[model samples]
Target: MKTPIIMIAMLSLSAPALAGGDMPVKTSTEVAYQDLNLATAQGQKKLSDRIDIAARRVCKLDNSITGTRIRDRDAERCYVAAKERANQQFAAVVEQHAKGG
Candidate 1:
C-alpha cells in the first residue's frame, strides 16, 4: 500500500505588500510529509525545515536593489508573519499526528 500523503499548505501571503505598494498580492506553497516518520525527532525536524523553505519562498521579495527602507522593512515583516503562521500550523499537525489522527 502507498503511504498517505500529508500536505500542509504552508502559507498564503495576503499580508501587507512586501513591495511597499497599496495592493495586496498572494503566494502559497504546500509541504508534503507522507514519507516522513513523524514518530521520530528527525522526521519532525525535516517537516519544520520544509515548512521554513516554503514560507521563505512565499514571502520573498527581490531585495536586489529595490532602494528604500520602507520596502526592506515590509519584506522583513512579511517573512516573519509568514514563518509564524506556518509554524503554528506545523505545531497543530504534529499534535494531531501524535494522537494517531
Candidate 2:
C-alpha cells in the first residue's frame, strides 16, 4: 500500500512532463494564417497584404545575402534563416491577436 502511494505521488509530480500537456503552442505564421482565415473579407485582404510584404522582404534579404550564384548549401542556410524569422514574426502576431490587441 505504501509503495503504491509513493508511486502515485511520483507520477503526479511528473505528470506534466510526461504528458506534455500545455498551451496550444502555435507559430506566428500559424496565428497570422488563422486570423486571416477567420477574418472578414477585408481583414483577410489586409493580412494577405502583410504576408506578401513579409515574404518579399525575406526573399530580397535571402537573395542579397546568398547572391544570384547561390549553391545548394547557401540556399539552405538562407532558407533556414528566413524561415526562423518568419516563424518568430508569425508567433508574435498570433500572441498579440490572442491578447485582443
Candidate 3:
C-alpha cells in the first residue's frame, strides 16, 4: 500500500513536467506569424498603403477622374482589399501555428 501511494505521488509530480517539457518550442517562422498576428492593425495599415498606391495608379490612368470621387472610391476599395488580405494572412498564421510549422 505504501509503495503504491509513493508511485502515485511520483507520477502526479512528474506528469506536468513531462507534458510541458516534451512540447517543442515555436520555430522562427511561427514566431514571426504570431508577431504579425499581434500587430494586425499595423499590418492592415501597411497593406492599405499598398492598395492606395495601386488604386491611385488606376485612377491616374483613367481620364474622367474627379479628385473627390477618385479618393472616395480608392479609399473604399483599399479598405476592403486590405481587410481581405489581412484576414487571409491571419488565417495562414493560424494554420502555421496549428501545424507547428
Candidate 4:
C-alpha cells in the first residue's frame, strides 16, 4: 500500500531572563500525522489531541524550579508565546483538515 501523507510539526519557545538567564530554557512539542485520511474529522481530532498532549508534556513544570518567582514569571510568558506559535503554525493545516480538502 502507498504510504499516507505525513505532516510533522515541531515548535520550541522560550526567552532569556533580564540579564543572566540560562539558555532561554526551550520547551517544545513535535507531532506527527500519518493517518490514512487526515482530511477527515476523526483524523484531525486525533492529530489535535496528540499535539495538545505533546505541548502539555513539554510545558510541564519542573518541581525543582516551581517555587522560584522569577522562573514562574518566565514560565508563564514562555507558555503563552509557545502556545501562540503552535497555533499560528498549525492553523492552516487544521483548517485544511476540517474543510476536508
Number of the top-ranking candidate, with TM-score as the measure? 1
Q: Rank the candidates by lDDT, best first.
A: 1, 4, 2, 3
The residue-by-residue lDDT of candidate 1 on 1-101, one tens digit each, is 42333333323334445456555555566777888888889999998888767665666644454566454455567677777777777777778789886
Local distance difference test values of all predictions, in order: 0.65, 0.41, 0.37, 0.53
Off by over 4 Å in 2: 1-35, 38-71
Q: What is the C-alpha lDDT profile of model 2 across 1-101, one tens digit per residue? A: 11100000001112344479754322222213543532256754565456544544433433453355653443344445545565555455545655665
Error at 96, model 2, angstroms? 0.4
What's the TM-score of each model vs. the native? 0.68, 0.35, 0.31, 0.52
Better structure of 1 and 4 per lDDT:
1
Better of 2 and 3 by TM-score: 2
Tens digit of lDDT per residue, candidate 4, span 2-90? 23333323233333442455444444546666553566677766766665666545665332464554445444555555556666646
How close to the true structure is residue 98 of candidate 4, measured as C-alpha lDDT? Answer: 64
TM-score of 3: 0.31
Model with the higher TM-score, candidate 1 or 4: 1
